[model samples]
Target: MEYDVVVLGAGPTGENVADRTRAAGLSTAVVEGELVGGECSYWACMPSKALLRPVIAGSDARRVPGLRQAVGGPLGTEAVLAHRDEMTSHWKDDGQVSWLDGIGARLYRGQGRLHGPRRVVVEGPEGEHHVLTARHAVAVCTGSRAALPDLPGLNGARAWTSREATSAHAAPRRLVVVGGGVVGTEMATAWQGLGSQVTLLVRGQGLLPRMEPFVGEHIAKSLTEAGATVRTGVGVAAVNRPDPGGPVTVVLDGGELIEADELLFATGRAPRTDDIGLDTVGLQPGSWLSVDDSCRVDGHDWLYGVGDVNRRALLTHQGKYQARIAGAAIVARARHCPLLETDRWGAHAATADHDAVPQVVFTDPEAAAVGLSLAQARAAGHRVRAVDKDLAAIAGASLFVDDYRGRARMVVDLDRQIVLGVTFVGPGVSELLHSATIAVAGEVPIDRLWHAVPSYPTISEVWLRLLEGYRDGADGGDGTDDGADGGDGTDGDTDGTDGRGGRGQGG
Candidate 1:
């Protein structure tokens, strides 16, 4: 056997697994044909945030130092894109290669397929063949690609995916988007900031339907205010890209034709688990090596799958989380160490994946949430209560934007007295997610969380306000704890006494 572990696709998750396995004193080999950092590092999150960070800085700049603009100014589109490419090493795959070598894991630049249990056949980039036999495990972490919709004329025309939009050097005069999900919304925000006349066509009533409605509402407002036209409940009927810089016309089902220089499909992603030799190992597409809390691939206990390839939630963080656990699981199996488990860690073992995977849309008035929404929670048979606040009323928002207009919400499990979910949508609120995530994951009781105080004048103060409102509303004109609110703090987030002081203010 060449090694103890063989990991396919050297994306972030794959790299993590390889690194972890190596640290456990096991020989590991990583196979890759593309950049190791994967989509998020090169195209999606890194560059997208690069574009937004400047807009945020410029907003602060124009607000304080330079006068006469509501922070609306061109952000040197070409320069910003050039910087993005530079950060990505001009889409070069070498930077990742160097990192892989530094980690002491063997690297194979090739197309890899499972020949059988513990065996893989690799077709190298230069057409060389190598067979690897793993003494312990083989893992699939292939990630995913943009899912294309079967819209008429979609393929026949010059359309873009998240890949093109994120790495494109040239900016279009007008841009039309086909989906209103996270990728679509964030790309729309980036392009709009970079001076593209942007139009978003959504199939739902609002963008970000998966996040809370409050989040969707705030994103719609912020995008609209920033001069982007959003049309919902409309799917593209057809596309026609006839000539150079000619308008790409998307005929709507409702007899409307939208024109733009370029069209982008921000539809969701599909796992890249095809033709990787799953069948030889008794695996199927949807059933590709199912695992338990130990992430052990079913049937073949030594085989593992991670990242977007498992048809799991396609977030980079989730991928890395799975990789870390898988690596540790490998170590545990080798040393006969009792498996270390946590909800967010070993939780990768089953179909309960969505129990609390946090999703964030990094737009202006950024939206983020974890766990189930109100409807989802109720349908899952939990008595639910929700508290929503116009962020404008929170000290956090008032301090951040003086004329603040944002939205937030917290969902509580009445029986559990813990936050099942929470959301924040506004400028500079990205860092506020950990509190909610910790609360939900830990299932922290409402009262104990009161001791987990948020610093003053921060957006997290909204957490205190949300608990207070739920407590007040649950009082029902009389203070009583019938476990009625089932809120994260409906019973104890606030002291029953009305003494709202001692959280001294800070910016």
Candidate 2:
């Protein structure tokens, strides 16, 4: 078989790359050994979010006085699992395959590896060998896998990764989560809300160490209040499970033992390049591929690496963004046209990968952030100011929940007077992230942002408060200050003790 482009994985990144190539009138082929929609569709994003929605909704309802009494019951676990099945198409990939067919891309079901240069060979299910040659480009979008530490007896313990945690038919009564990053915290949140007694063990000082310090603090507080035991500054020493289906006993570093029905290790992710025939191309196996701004692999114009394999932003949306850029670049190169301006935000450049990646963690009081955090900006040698405001001070937030506990912060570059990054940790803040993403990505100036006013009595009013705080500090001749004291300046009843009578009707 021959194609203009051959994508090595059928994940979201690969799918999008193939989509763009076929749209450019190029024949594309996608090969996968598993389901077509890949991990995000079946195991990571879809199933996890489906399991989290009801839990979050129930939490939100509990925060409202009138609705609190109505939700004082256990979740409909069976219904939620069934809906998750529906969202993942019951673990089938026929629909995704059809979508590829409709787009005129060939779907090959097998294990694919690079033979050499532009050549690929696939070993099919029935021991049949198929060779595919890419005329223009080959994109490796194999994504990543869970990285587990080499703990004694861990392999035989039948522990869960993100896959097993998200796709399990039944929730374990006792669940012990390892790691403190997004996967660990999120899975802990989901299982705890779904009626599991979750114990989250973090080897670090706190959760989400990469984000703002307050983010981890707030989440730890919420998780503790919600009946999950979050233990930080601890490491798992060993695992013992004589029977795969039986309970597992975990030994912590200080000889403390904890038993749980199931164990989940969300430590980290490693690139999926170990067995993808990177050796044939003179690239190291199991190593992350370095790519240019156009996502073409370093030193290989005809080879591209998108998604987690490239070591860019590891989020699904970021991968899709890179896929679009890489796809366009490939098509342009094949047409013998000058790659459309490779500058930042150019037609073929993935500028956002550097300074505008956005992420949302759907835990209680959902945490969303984009671009650089305060620490990151400081470390990068940027003169930045951080302005923070209490989310409960927003009228819409009061109307949303009785005592909405959240905070919003914006980091501004002093020289440019534009937002470097924004972080929102509160209820319903996920939807507000794109505004900040656009502001940072577009390099919108602070003065111009002030003119783009937020509506009154809305959670978005927090933006107004943040900007007001920044301006006030500037007017007072305190350049690049940290407005950490909720910044509203009213000073009266700022702790949300006032009744929620003056807010908008709905959240």
Candidate 3:
């Protein structure tokens, strides 16, 4: 069978691309071997967040003075597990399949691989073979899979990857999490909150090595306080599980052995390109595909690589953004229309992938950031300055919790006086990230940002404090200048109190 577009993965990226192409009057067919909605729908994002939301809510309730004693108990494990199952649709894809039907895209339930230029071959579960040809383009949105380290005896140990960690029916009593990246930290947080003794093992000096150093420091402190053992600067040398159903023993580099009911290796991710027949198209298998701003594969105008396979931003939202751009580009090509203005922020350009990618880590004291960190900005040769503020000083934070422990920072590009990046680590700060994303993506000037006032007595007022800090620093003096409010330049009480003397502050 032939169509105007054939998307080789029915994940979020592929679904979005198919939707766009279908909307543009193209005949699109999406192929997948697994559930239609893919990883984010069943395993990674949705199910994980479903499990964590109640844990976070319980923590939030316990933080309030009047609610503390009432909600100090452990999470209801059975209920949480059931809720997670509901969120993942009990691992069913019927709803997603119905949505594809509504979108006018044909669905092929099989493993899809490139056979040749604009050609795909699907090998069905029943051993039937089918060929699909694309008249306009073929998009590879196969995404990625968790990459585990090659330690001795690891594979046979039945180690938990992000898949198992998120989808496990029951939480392990003792969970040993390996790696300090998002998957490791978040799973540790979720399992620990759900009554597991979680020990996080990281070879690096801290968690979240990609973000600002302080962000990791804050999260590590909170995790430790919450009764999770966080071990840094340690690598696993080997693993042994003589009995498949018994506990696994992890041997560390310095000869220390740790036993746990479950061991999860959240090391990293590898592109899912190993068996998609890239060799037939002159591209190496297992290599991340290179794509232009319009998501067209390098040197192949009819080939597009959207999502994690493209090696652009690995986040789901970013993949959808690329899908939109790629769909538009494909439609333009199909119609024989001259491509117009494919520059940054153009209708068919994925400019945000490079400069304005935003991510939120939904651990306790949610960590969110957008754009480049201070070090990244400096390394990129931008004249930048970083401004910091303790989130506890924000009035809304204190009102939200007695001892709200968090911090916020903004990296400013001095040459253009625009925000280069913004990082927020605190309770309920995830909602504040889009503002930073907009500022960075739009290149809003510092002087202009000063006029955009944050509401008084709100957590967002931290924006005002940040801008004030920048102004004070730009004036070349200590941040003690008197202001119209008859106060020092410091926005909040230095002693970490909300000035009401209700409770002592320390997150």
Per-model C-alpha lDDT, please? 0.72, 0.85, 0.84
Candidate 1's C-alpha runs over 4 A off are: 59-72, 244-246, 285-289, 336-352, 475-507
Which residue pairs does candidate 3 place in steric collision? none
Best-to-worst order by TM-score is: 2, 3, 1
Structural similarity to truth (TM-score) of each candidate? 0.88, 0.94, 0.93
Ten contiguous residues with the weakest lDDT in model 3? 492-501
Q: Model 3 clash tally?
A: 0
Looking at model 3, residue 410 earns an lDDT score of 86
Better of 1 and 3 by lDDT: 3
RMSD of each: 8.1, 7.3, 8.2
Task: Return the top candidate by TM-score.
Answer: 2
Give, for candidate 1, the lowest lDDT window spanning 10 residues.
Answer: 491-500
Screening candidate 2 with a backbone cut-off below 3 angstroms (N, C-alpha, C), the clashing residue pairs are: none
Candidate 2 on 1-507: residue-level lDDT in tens? 899999999888888899899999999999898878777888887788888899999999998988999999999999999998887878877777777788899988899999899989999888898899999999999988888899998989999998899899998999999988888888888889999999999998888876777787889999999999999989999999998778999999999999999999988888989988999999999999999999999999799999888877778788888889999999999999998579989989999988998988888879998998887787788877888888988999998888899988898988889999898998899999999999999999999998888887779888898899898776423233453421211110000000011110000
Q: How big is the positional error of residue 354 in model 1, measured in Å on the Cα after superposition?
A: 3.9
Name the regions of candidate 3 deviating beyond 4 angstroms.
475-507
